[model samples]
Target: MPRTEVPPVLVTGATGRVGRVVVDLLMDAGVPVRAVTHRSEAAATLPADVEVVTGDLTVPESLDAGLRGAGAVFLVWTVPPATAPAVVERLAVSTRRVVFLSSPHRTPHPFFRQPNPMAVLHADIERLIAAAGLETTVIRPGMFASNAMFWWATAIRADGVVRWPYGAAETAPVDERDVAAVAALALCQDEHAGGDYVLTGPESLSQAEQVSIIGDVVGRRIAFEELSPDEFRRETEGSWPRPVVDMLLAAWGATMGRPAFVTSTVLDVLGSAPRSFRQFVADHATVFIDPTPSR
Candidate 1:
């Protein structure tokens, strides 16, 4: 288990919120990268030097070329549960290590302990990885800071106001960039094998406090208005899946008046502090600024 130059690593979901960044980090480290995506168009966005291959995780057979000669694989199981075994088996046959993006189901934190179906899926995948005898590492990232783009960006961009449910509901929003960085290291290094890292921001902040921090970073005096859970539900009913909406409502309601769970795992693994929500906002402030306003 000593460090050595690894063969090309296959990055599934390479065009995803975190996978693209993982690909970038791997390329930066001079680690060979084979970016896996289902669509040929996604290849255009990745670094030209990377070996872009079309592979669907749900269909294990499609991954043969991408997984060939790969020393490790970054696995993100975004599909349904039925095909997971075949995929993991193919991965086990092709690579010695796998770094899986999973949920913090075992963290004992109320924010992450909700009875969510995705958590169940993640658990099943983790079990598969272990059973397949792949040297595995599980990365459990809490609420992603990028969620603001969906949760509040439109309102913030239009009117500097974030109106949503449970204004004081607390949770640490970890940065996806940090998640990718940790994943890149884990994918390339043997030291992180058989590890379970529950990643989170350095500090906890409530929904309202997070909005305020974004406002500060964006140089705007934004306002946070508490909304009824019903309002949020009604607004997102058609867009988000019912189970997801239910999980969110349950999690936020449970965390009302309580601080989110914070962990030192990011710093412990990376030897540096995880990016704060403030820093995340500052870096992506443009996304909060309106481009077109009502005339």
Candidate 2:
């Protein structure tokens, strides 16, 4: 595992929300990037400067082209569980370091005590990465600010009323850009190796408070109505996977009477406070504006 002055870094899930930002930040730091995706045609969408290559992490042999000459890798596991061992093992043999984007499992809080299938997968992959003797940096980001779009965008667009369960459940939502920035730093520098960074925004605010902040930023009064667990389950059953719904309900329920876990890893790593929820809403406010016309 020889280090170079400026080695090419491989970014898996290059086109995804956080991955795209990671790629941009890495490139801005003068690091050559190799963006890996399963679909070769998707390469057209990435920047012309990026070396877009087709590679499937689950299929280790498929990663040959993308892994070649790369000193570090940004791994965003988006595949089935069965192939994780092989993928991580292959990564260990291919690259000098791996920066994995994972959830906040180590946070000592009720909100993270639930049984999440994704967290299970992340743990398994992390063990594999360590067993392989690779320099690994695990970034555990708390609730994402972008979650507002999935949870309340439609209601905000329609009537500006967010009807949901456990509005009192507090969370320190970290912006995806901050997550990406820290990840990019890990990939480009040697100092971040062996670091387990738990990232979150500066403030710990409840769901209702977050919505109110969004309303303030968006220039209106958005109402928050707490829904019953049963109602939330019923509404999301047909749309969201059962396990996912159960996980959210349990996490939110557990955090109802507790404040979310917050950490200053973002500031420690990037030397600045992470983006606030209000800024997130202000930037993407158009998405929450109702598109339909009514009489």
**TM-score of predicted structure 1:** 0.96
lDDT of each: 0.90, 0.88
The candidate that achieves the highest lDDT relative to the unseen native structure = 1
State residue 289's C-alpha deviation in candidate 1, in Å. Answer: 0.6
Off by over 4 Å in 1: 1-5, 293-295
Q: What's the true lDDT of residue 105 in model 1?
A: 83
lDDT of 1 at 259: 84
Estimate the overall C-alpha local distance difference test score of candidate 1: 0.90
Q: Name the candidate that leads on TM-score.
A: 1
lDDT of 1 by residue, 1-295 (tens): 9887669999998999999999999999999999999989878898888889999877789999988899999998888899899998898998899999997888776777778999999999999999999999999999999998778998898888787898888889999999999999999789999889999998889888899888888788899887798888888888888888889999899887788989998899999999999999989988998777578
Poorest stretch of ten by lDDT in candidate 2: 286-295
Q: What is the TM-score of each predicted model, taking all chains together?
A: 0.96, 0.94
